[model samples]
Target: MRPLKRLVEQFLESEAKGGILLFVTALAAFVLSNSPWAQAYFDLRDVYLKLQVGDWVLKKTLLHFVNDFLMALFFLLVGLELKREILQGELKNPRQAGLAVAAALGGMVTPALIYTAFNYGGEGAAGWGVPMATDIAFALGVLSLLGKRVPLSLKVFLTALAIVDDLGAVLVIALFYTSQLNVTALLVAALVFGFALLLGALRVRSLTVYMLVGLVLWYYVLLSGVHATIAGVLLAFAIPIGRARPLPPHADGVAEDPELHEAQLELLEDAAREAQSPLHRLEHLLHPYVAYFIMPVFAFFNAGVALEGAQVGSIALGIFFGLLLGKPLGILLFSYLAVRLGIARLPSGVGWGAIAGVGLVAGVGFTMALFIAGLAFDAALLDEAKLGVLSASVTAAVLGSLLLWKTAAPRPS
Candidate 1:
């Protein structure tokens, strides 16, 4: 219980801080895009920035490298979180998982349907997946602002729902957003993946070994026309989940030998403790890397969308309605139906008000939506998707925060 409480506290704090950073980054992007130096702001990406050495060199447009390479680390952290949750978190339990899975499916399907309704049989039809995302950071941040008023069960539900939402986004990218497959590159990627699995089977524990091989996998996947970020997800599955040792029972306050136990009890207790196990240490070591470095860098790169003139046209309308309406509609409707039909029960200590508030918060789809939009189209339609994403995300954030905050007071016991 102590560890669980600490985990929740840390998660909330990190998410709240990330939200503040995101707000500043987005505001800067909007101002820079609309300012007198707009061209310079845009052209900042085109300027050459490289590391030149005798035998090694690296060069890329400022934004291109940030968006592609830096974002991969973000995806890598995401992949790790997904893997951890599937193994040991709320997702590890079937009944606990079912509600979130159903709600996420409803959230995704309804939004796509809504977006399709707006852009069906039109040039911008492929943009339907744009609104089917829920940014976990923003949602968690909103919940954090509500403090102890919001129940722990509600936070868990939101996290579970977002995890499932991410799974859906991964599928959408793999199925619909991919381009012409490059068989040769894909074959190379497969071989690299095979090598990673081979290392895992050999019980390689060093991250450096995986990192070296992962870079090759990342390159091959990038060239394979499958979204490069998916490589991060695939690679995370190969990482080992072995723990170092099990906690031993304390020998204190109990007779060791019954005949002559009191004298030896302290020694037995000292020998039995295994609190600083290898696996526990590893989890602690990795947690900081995932929380601080990977996520913040991802936000800095991906969240900086050039918000120039707001596109309040068909695209923006489609995005806003899809998220604000679709997320809650899907979450509440499917959740209620599941409970009513006896498919799943509402989690203990959570009320409809908390669940509904979380559903609203789940509509804020900043990171994943932007990533999908990039995959769904090139520069031409990219702006339209971005417009939709920005509008819908802002609307979701504002309304979701309000609803959740408003409902955080004393509820029917």
Candidate 2:
């Protein structure tokens, strides 16, 4: 338990630093997009890339490789984090998880509904899922700016909420954004998934073996037209949650010798440490790469929307208002209802106003929103949606920071 707690703490600390880097990279991207080097930026993203093995070949632009292949790694990390939280982190307790769950649901539903009201039965209706995401890195980055003005409990609450929000986004992508299905490929993916599970059941702790099978699964799922990122999530669940088993008091020949008992216990501890599941190891190893490298590169590629001829029409307006207005409104309203109904209680040292402020911060839905926009709209409408996401994310970050700074109590001197 202490080890798990330490791992979570390390995760948050790295995330805070990563958030700063993400901001810097996004800013650089925006600058490059609007400057004289814009054509070079676009050209770099459009460069064709291909992989061939024998007669089989896969081809895509550089940007698609980033979006499809690299982002799948990002989602793989997300899935591992979600699994860890559910198994032993904050979400392990029902009461502790209730507030985040309710807040995430409201955050997702209200944004979708608000977007739908504007684009219902229209071409942009498919984009209702765009504003439903919360960029955890950006939101936490903003929160970290406040120093100790915010409580640790509040930060944990926000983190949990964002994780739940991510889960919702994953579901939406799997259910709504998927293209045509290929049954044969899906069966192949299933067979690979089953083999991975069998490895876990057999307690094969070699990460190399699991990863090899996972790559096969990812390829099959990619061919199945089910949005290949789902394969990452599926692979995550197959990884064993190997908790350390306690050493029995009367093991082997320790009954008559106290020193031998202590020696045996130490050996057991060492074995237990080594027995930690691949999920934890992979999550730890990949988190830094995902945060510092993959995400910043992703932002550089995806967030460079040209503002010269960009028009903010109804689609953009819907996304803007959905993120800016609908996010906070739904989060605060549902949270209040949950508290009043005794479904969940606020964290200690946190007030309704702070929660409202956090809700506003959750509206900084940049990365995931941009990714969904790519899926939800054509090239023409994609620019409009990106503009809305960029504008709303900035507004939400500013407003939420102000609200929290003004309302939060100062730390004890």
Best by TM-score: 2
The 10 consecutive residues of candidate 1 with the worst lDDT sum are 272-281
TM-score of 1: 0.86
lDDT of 2 by residue, 1-413 (tens): 56556666677778888888888888888888899999999999999999999999999899998888888888888888888889877788787788889899999999989999999998888999999999999999998899888877788888999999999999999999999999999999999999988887877777788788888988999999888878888888888777445434443334358767777778766665575678877887788899999999999999998899999887888898899999999899888888888878888888888998999999999989998999899988998999999899999999999999977665465
lDDT of 1 at 338: 78
lDDT of 1 by residue, 1-413 (tens): 67666776676677666765665666676566667877776677567678688976767776667666766666666676677778877788887888888889889988888888998887778888988999887778777777777777778788888978987898788789888999999999999999988876776777778878889898888889987877877777776665434444553256647776865665554554433432233445655664555555445444444555545666667777898898899898888887787767777777677677788888888878878777776776677777777777777778877887777554667
lDDT (C-alpha) at residue 296 in model 1: 52
Residue 2 of model 1 has an lDDT of 71
Count of backbone clashes for each model?
0, 0
- Model 2 off-target regions past 4 Å? 1-6, 244-273, 410-413
